[model samples]
Target: MKLFLIGYRGTGKTMIAKILATAWNCEWADSDGEIERRSGKSIAQIFSQDGEASFRKLEIEVVRDLATGPHKVVSLGGGAVMGTENRTTIAAQGLTCWLQATPATIAQRLEQDSATKSQRPDLTPLGGLEEIQTVLDQRFSVYQSCADFEFDTEGKSPNQVADEILVTVAKEQKMNS
Candidate 1:
């Protein structure tokens, strides 16, 4: 099954997906990257030029296409789980691991990431920590509902988080077997 990483931006989903894919010797795809590749535009550009509805349309298509393919790791965009159709599709397609972090931590990480400002768009008029907290509060329950597994990314490196995911997934597999 596909291993889908779902979480807020800057929660290390993309990094952990890379680590997990490397450990599993499988391919990995970043939904945001795929969206950008298909549209020939950055996420920020998509949001600003085409609008969020347009971006969501692309996101849904990308998620569905990725779900039907080989067993790979996918790092989904933060708000990808907000749509009912997206949540249902994800649930039916693969295992979802929620990579979580406090709003402060996410804000800090986003600030540190050089590409974030250029690639991603601000979801609210309140930018920085305030925006992060507001969005996280809105998405908390949705993320919880969609997650098959959850990991707090605070005080941990990407590899460390990936290690925890590997252990949990192995136990889950063993139990299922």
Candidate 2:
């Protein structure tokens, strides 16, 4: 089955997904990267030029495509779960892990990652931690609704998170079997 990483922008979904893919010997697909590849434009460009609505439409299409594909480690864009269809697809298609962190952690992480800042468009005009909290408040319920498991990414390295996911999955499988 597909293993999906769902979380806010700075929650290390991409990093953890890569680690999981490598450790599991499977392909890894990132929703944002795939959107960029398909559109021939960066996500920020898409948002600035075409608008968030258009970008979200594209996100739904990408999620649908990936949801129907074979097993792999998939990292979804931060806002992909905003769409009901996308959330449904994820819930039906994969084992989802919600990588969570505090608003302060998210703000700090984003501040540290210049490349990520360049690629993403601001969702709101609020500053720093306030913006993070605003976005989290809007999406936290959706993330929880679709996730089969939750992984805390705060103060954890990508390798550490990956190891935890592996152990958790093993335990789940052991229980289910």
* TM-scores, all models, native as reference: 0.98, 0.96
Off by over 4 Å in 2: none
Error of 2 at 83 (Å): 0.6
Clashes of each: 0, 0
Best-matching candidate per lDDT: 1
How far out, in Å, is residue 58 in model 1? Answer: 0.7
Q: Which ten residues in a row have the lowest lDDT in candidate 1?
A: 63-72
Give candidates' CA RMSD values in order.
0.6, 1.0
TM-score: model 1 vs. ground truth: 0.98
lDDT of 2 by residue, 19-53 (tens): 99999888899999999999999999999999999
Clashing pairs in 1: none
The digit string of per-residue lDDT tens for model 1 on 63-151 reads: 99988878899999999999888899989988999999998899899999999899989999999999999999999999999999999
Best by TM-score: 1
Clashing pairs in 2: none
- Cα lDDT listed for each candidate: 0.94, 0.91
